[model samples]
Target: MSILFTRLRHTLLPRRNTVARPSDRIQVALLLLLLLLSLAAAAGAILLGAGIHVVESARSVEQTASRYATTAVLLADGPSPGTVGRSGTAGEPGPARATWVTRNGRRHTGDVDAPAGTVAGNEVPVWLDATGAPAERPLTPLAAAVDATAIAAGGWAAVGFLLWLAYRCAVFVLDRFRLARWK
Candidate 1:
């Protein structure tokens, strides 16, 4: 058992002649720098990816809201009321309120009220739920533009980070090769 342990120790220990060469110092420095650069770039890329994900999620929500929205014309010229009413029974008539016009021009009358933004004679977009009820509010063009800009920025940032990482890796490899040749 002692002999076996001695053999294992001898195998694990490094030989004196295997010590790093003079040129290896520069190689080590370059490798350290490369590792740092890689870490920094990875962090930047992760941040960019997260930003992109947020933008995409916003976009998806907007798209889904738009899909669920119904097209309606204002019955009277005024802002929509904040409260909306549901369909009444056969004997009970629905509340007196504005009606929504679908894409097919089908008039659906209901007491469901929307926020005051639409005016009579003005065609506005409105979202409706599965129960044929209004759902989402209006979206401004500025909001959409901001979302697009965020997505673009995130994509560009990710690309820039990857390019920087590539550059650092190339420089590290070239430096290591030069040092090896010098020895």
Candidate 2:
């Protein structure tokens, strides 16, 4: 492994007692610049992802803090083929009428997504907002982590692609110039 690395390192360095071609030098410089830019972009992407995660987590905590969880009894059968979401996809949970009691002991009835074929009187978990209305569950920590990682990876990949593109274009132009000079 060490020998392989030394060989790789030596391949990039100018050999002694020989003059390197200007075009080769320019290619190497552009490659190094691309590497630097990729590193900088990775750092920036990580920071942005971290900031987003922090903000999202804080908001999740704040929103879920006052909200409480309880069970809602289904008031009807879960959505059937005719009552699927707008896209009309099957197998996905669909909204069904339900009733639940809030943290303040107030009773309320509304719609909640329950698994297909759920029958009336079946109990399902429900999240209630501060106003004591049924609401979506708060964002979980796993979701925040996944969101941050995806954003960071996407940002880094986009920057890396642009830098690579720039490097290729520069090398292409340099090669053409060198060819013209040689002719």
Candidate 3:
């Protein structure tokens, strides 16, 4: 620990024997500024995570209030027809026709996604909105938190990488100037 501290101290406050070059001072200042910005980015990550959680929570609350789960019997096969999301890629779950009773005690039949290889007459649980329409499952709090964390981590990593690239470019320019002076 002491060895690490010594290295850090030296790196942050190197001993100077003579007047420092203007370029050297500028480089140091810019590095310090980048460090400060990195700290701010860390804080921003937390705020972003909190924002994600809040949005997901509100959506879950709305879904739970407006939707209810009901048991449904498969009319044909498992899985639904067409793509399930924006990507237009079908998941392992296939499309099938299922029948269930709504909250108002009305019988309804619709197409829903079911486990692969599911046959007709198989009973399955499905979510329905207040209007007796089929609805997707709501995101859970845990899932929201995980997604937020991943996104924040990716953001921080990107910032760090950009800073490193900028530092390398600065070093290259400073080296070129020093070489020109020597020549």
Measured by TM-score, the strongest candidate is 2
Instruction: Please give the range of 10 consecutive residues that has the lowest summed lDDT in model 2.
Output: 79-88
lDDT of each: 0.57, 0.84, 0.79
Please, what are the lDDT tens digits per residue for candidate 2 over residues 9-80? 655675655566867777887888788989999999999999989988887788779677899999998866
On lDDT, the leading prediction is: 2
Model 3: worst 10 consecutive residues (lDDT sum): 79-88
lDDT of 1 at 164: 64
State how far residue 74 of model 2 sits from its true place (Å): 1.5
RMSD of each: 15.8, 2.4, 3.5
The runs of at least 3 residues in candidate 2 whose Cα sits more than 4 Å from the true structure, single-residue gaps closed, are 1-7, 15-19, 81-84
Give the per-residue lDDT digits (tens) of candidate 1, residues 1-59.
99999865544443458665544454455556655766676566557656656666676
Residue 40 C-alpha lDDT in model 3: 89
What TM-score would every model get versus the actual structure? Answer: 0.34, 0.85, 0.81
TM-score, predicted candidate 1 vs. hidden true structure? 0.34
TM-score of 2: 0.85
Better of 2 and 3 by TM-score: 2
Off by over 4 Å in 1: 1-18, 69-183
Enumerate clash totals for all models, in the order shown: 6, 0, 4
Better model by TM-score: candidate 1 vs candidate 3: 3
